[model samples]
Target: MRYEVWAPSASQVTLHADGRAYPMRREDGGWWRRAAPGTDGTRYGFALDDGPALPDPRARRLPDGPDGLAAVLDPTLSVWRHDWPGRPLPGAVLYELHVGTFTRTGTFEAAAEHLPHLAQLGVTHIELMPVCPFPGTHGWGYDGVAPWAVHEPYGGPGGLVRFVDAAHALGLGVVLDVVHNHLGPSGNHLPAFGPYFTDRHHTPWGAAVNLGEPEVRAYFTNSALAWLRDYRLDGLRLDAIHALTPRAPFLPELSSAVDELSQSLSRPLFLIAESDLNDPLTTTPRSSGGHGLHAQWNDDFHHALHTALTGESQGYYADFAADPAQALAKILRGGFFHDGTYSSFRNRPHGHPLNPSTTPPYRLLAYTQTHDQIGNRAQGDRLSAHLSPGLLACAAALTLCSPFTPMLFMGEEWGARTPWQYFTDHPDPALAEAVRTGRRREFAAHGWPSDAIPDPQSPETRLRSCLDWDEPKREPHARLLAWYRRLIALRRATPALTDPDWSYTALSTDDRTVHFRRGPVHLAVNLSPQPAALALGGTAAIVAAWSPVAPPDGAGVLHLPPETAAVLLAT
Candidate 1:
């Protein structure tokens, strides 16, 4: 196959083949090279006579820096044995993990050790934080430099293949989080070859990846399929897709392309959209004037649940904490916040009510704690520090017992003590300093003291974020683990919990207790510190409790102790 690098501004381009550097022809206003016999592994780098040497635009397997010689890699050689397909639907439990912090090794091989514990949690899917190669070893994978290649430190492409194979062997499905918006500044060498990004659109990170031009559009779809076909990824969690808006027509062609590819693949592929638009169209079918996604992260639910549980009102949390009982009730039953009401955040009326009767409930992924809520904090402290034990149990129940696909962040199950701090190991000194300054500026808007913000580039930041394997084996941590294990067991036992019909469930809450009704199962949660009498929607048979004490067994008033939760079946 012939290789081409786009350095349109270069006066002369040289393709270093083997030991010889041969000047390439400027065909069609770009550099071109044809491989000779036995040239599959021939390493080549582009020498722009005017500018410094840059990496190949389509370098799939980069063992070295961007300036290192790029070679043509055959993707067919990698033997994938992930024969089993992913989860069927709401039947699956998901665990969201950060590649860098999952283990101290921070490589794919090191992460393999925890796959067994995940299986014990009855987890069916493992959602890996972005694997796209970034500058350094530490990051949430949001700032990816190479959208296609796996990060080298995290075992690169080969280690990833082994990780996936191992996960499937343990009967777990793997979903990859991919950032299609902006590239991290450090190791990004794409612009040196082609106009992969457009000056028209810009996201919070930087200019959005170009999906307008024909070749650019093709590139993204190809990348999407490669994960499924080559890496054996079951699903693609589309990150910040709301930031992607097409030029004039306003038609979201990206969604259409994904759907088309999913159709052609003929496999059980899933697409989860992570959008805060609160627009049901994000998960709605394309025929219904929506972006045909399988399911999307429900931020409104998180906001309502977080504010209600923790009561920390700053920035976006301010608009939500006002009437959290009502906000959460709507999300619990309807799946969105605005539900045709006005939103103070956007200062406008927004969101259509989700048709719970017609719409499957699992389409919404609910979580009280996620990386955003934790890492975005002045200190990346988990909610374990903020809420009481009862409240923590309440939040986990709210997610797992609700009519949605529940997701648990890493270290959330046992109430991990270590905070998931934001850290970067960028090679570029200027970019590293810029990140620190940017973080300080962002937190200041939320009333956080600028000087108190931890440096995003510091070693202490990443070190603090690493999980302590011993923590789960001890104390209130052990108690927290037991609570989660029992809750997950109960959630799996009760078919009503995962039922798709939202209409079958009813919820009513006061300031002290939150009530959830699924068919005959009633979950009453006490958020207060003192014992209180709670009126049951109906008389219930006690099935489960978060604490050691059993709830009263009767068809009358149920009494609960401080920071307690109970699950019951109507007698």
Candidate 2:
């Protein structure tokens, strides 16, 4: 219940609480400590020396929005009647969603209306994209300035609390995506206080957050802990950890801090890092001389799968277009394409050697399509707009049945036609224009035409990104929805499809179909125009297939309909 304010620039600091101000003693390294209203849930802010009162960088609970007073919330407060033993993280199916577009009202309470639907979809965990306060109402949330405060439009802190509490009550774990690499451009006023960033360590966005600086580390780490400590969040989906450069002792410091914080938390606090560097040390245990992060986003698996399905070999996808079965084999068993293989895109060998015995297969989170894959496009179009239904189903089946954990974008389940584009509502006119201009140029480097790019500043872009709530009830949308439900149900029910062994899984592809086998699961996908005969795995049991052909094949010889997927089992 105590409050700590890091304001090195200010000479004197006072606790603005209970409609009265009390002086706080300056503690270690410019931090002001006070024992004011530790028992009472009073709202407080740090009044600088003759300057305006500033919100605490490590504010536990915000009651009056980001610009308003901060509150000291006790965890024991407000009855938490729900009690159930915890479940392991390996078997979870995560559904990633943006709070702004998940509902019409877009508040946490509003999002609660869809709980039954999530439960029915077999979504074990719901990963909310960054809810931290940004410049305006809508965004992809990577540009978050006030990392401690929830976005006001999404009903602020109380709404987020309600959402998490509700999710737990429904037996759904909530993982909050947090941005620790850099703050947003417009409303980011952190540097006004002290050296929160350093020029020596620069990210793609301005100077990186000075994690090595005494107070800066406290600010960032404390902000991350707030969600788990106050919001009762189950895990932290760390964003762009490759950019989180700790100047001194980078690996152990950041990883140990996260590991320690997870241990200190009330419930199991899992940390999933979004890292591009395919280093095995990321998920390795601390005792084994590695960072103790629980898991990391598997972009290699995505790139491999994406290139194989679409055959659009450009940018990073250049390394993965040789064979469809390569992706099918790597993602199904080992988890990544760059498993010490020579990466032509990087012009050198990338990724360290992974220990099959030491490294757990579940340390990677895989997906065929996601918000980044959809939104990063010039037109903000989903894969459904580009690929055939059969190819799309092939990609979906691989993601769901793969050994590594699977995560779905908001509308990905039902094949929602509406796009999850990269949209931002930056109130500043100059900042908005800069963003639009920057985005266009960024895409141009990757061979995208300038004229084809959508302006990020335009209202049309944001409107286009909104989930068409009615897409679920329509023709192709309804069909895709049923397909996803059946696939997910099979994934949950079938033990063969859930096997996690990168080395053991095998794939064989010809002009006819792609054969994938992981343990007892055998998925034969017919990609040709004609009715391609599927050669099932020798040891696999017949569980299910997409019924690839029109009429069912008798004699226990499955007839795969054209462009359909057959999920089978080895008995």
Candidate 3:
């Protein structure tokens, strides 16, 4: 077998495999290679300039975690039981889940047992949070050091293979979230191997990954393809593309490569970027000189809707809180609220306007809450913790009934009571203390008492984030779940709800209510504390509603209870 590594800075390279060491010869493009008698399950690592051996930068399986030696395993060797066609993004209802806390056992095998529940929930795709190897057994999976390998604690590569196969059998597509901007602080050995990162640009984590180099770009691109091709994943959700300050046009290049692979496989493979730039170019076609990603997370819509429902005016929520209804109305008509507008949070003009005629609304993924929105909070409390069942149903109605592609965070369908807190497991005591201190200090600066903030390093914090399966079987929770089921069913059944056209969409708002129309379907949400009598443009029949909605009056006005939403079909 041939062993290879990229260590341009090293004068000497050695391949340590299967308890034997062999000198490697320098190859072109800053790579070192050597042939050895080894097969699958062979332990391997690379030593640079007589230094300690490090795991392969692109190791497919890290059997002993990121700090341990990598195992040589053929990914194609895994057997797939089901044949999956593919699921596209146009009309998909995405459900994002974290593998560790998704089930009681926190393993891929255990998570697979709940696939039937998601299929029944009417979500077309399950977006799994990063499963790459991190420091410990539990985490949000964002600070993963190995961008290519699966976390062994979550069943490694084979476990993910089995999980995807099971999901395919249930007619569900799986999308994995990937982090390429920066790796975790501890156990990251990429810099030692080569100039994978550069000090030319820095992100929140530190030096950015060097994407200008041809070989470095290939490293990340190949890792993404391996996940989709080898694991049979439908797509990938890129975490924070805005943080990446690549001197080269990496997004466009990545998209082109992915498109070529999608053609070869004859499947609908795609990429979704988590960007706050509010740039339509992120989703525009490559031929039009755009990045050509299939879709992006619409944080503008989330902020507007969140502030409206919760009356929050802190930090980024300040701008949206001024006039909640108007904010929601603007996002409904166009795709973004910031569209070349001044942002009070940033104190600058942010985002470019998107043409409704040129850009389809479905290119934006809208959600009520996300991992960052929930987990990063002081207490990691979900909206369900404070909002009533009626209000939660209202949020469901607006998102599902909107023109954009809707996504649900795990346990949102049933309003899972457990909090999805920020938790980490770093074996290093000093690193753990630093994380604990930083988390508390950040929240404390924002007026939250330090004691009120959960310790990210505490084991109890991770346990508190697990979803309670029994919650869905109880009152209010069961009712909310039923509401989500009906809303999703209606979206699938009603052509107007899933319509991608933005020109056909219209919105109107009063002091306490926001109304929008998608073709013949009109949705009105009452945001006030008192009952609202919203004027429908024409005579309509109540199709779906969060609470008991009174019939339209003689003048075509519907009386909706406070904190309620109704979807009406024009007669």
Compare the candidates by lDDT and give the number of the best one.
Answer: 3
Task: Rank candidates, TM-score, best first.
Answer: 3, 1, 2
The root-mean-square deviation over C-alpha atoms between each candidate and the true structure, in angstroms, is 2.8, 3.0, 1.2
Candidate 3 per-residue lDDT, tens place, 302-375, comes to 99889988988999999898997788888888899999999999999999999665579888999999999999
- List TM-score per model, in order: 0.92, 0.90, 0.98
* Model 1 error, position 44 (Å): 3.2
| Cα-based lDDT at residue 366, candidate 2 | 86
Candidate 3 TM-score, C-alpha based: 0.98
Q: Which stretches of candidate 1 lie over 4 Å from their true place?
A: 1-14, 17-33, 37-42, 46-53, 79-82, 247-266, 549-553
How well is each residue in 496-534 modelled by candidate 1, as lDDT tens digits?
Answer: 888888774567887767787888888877777887677
Q: What is the C-alpha lDDT profile of model 2 across 1-571, one tens digit per residue?
A: 4566777777888888867788888877877787766553577777888666666666555555455666666555544556634444677788998887786566778888888778877878999999887777777788877787778788777677777777878899988998888987766667766888999889999898887786677666667776776677778888988898763355456667766766665356678889888888888887887777788899988887777667778878888777756555655556667877888888998887677666667778988777787888777787787777777777777778777888988888777777766778888888888888898899888778988888777667776766777888887777767777777888888765555555555677764467766666777777665776654535445455544343224433456767777677665
Report lDDT (CA) for all predictions.
0.77, 0.74, 0.90
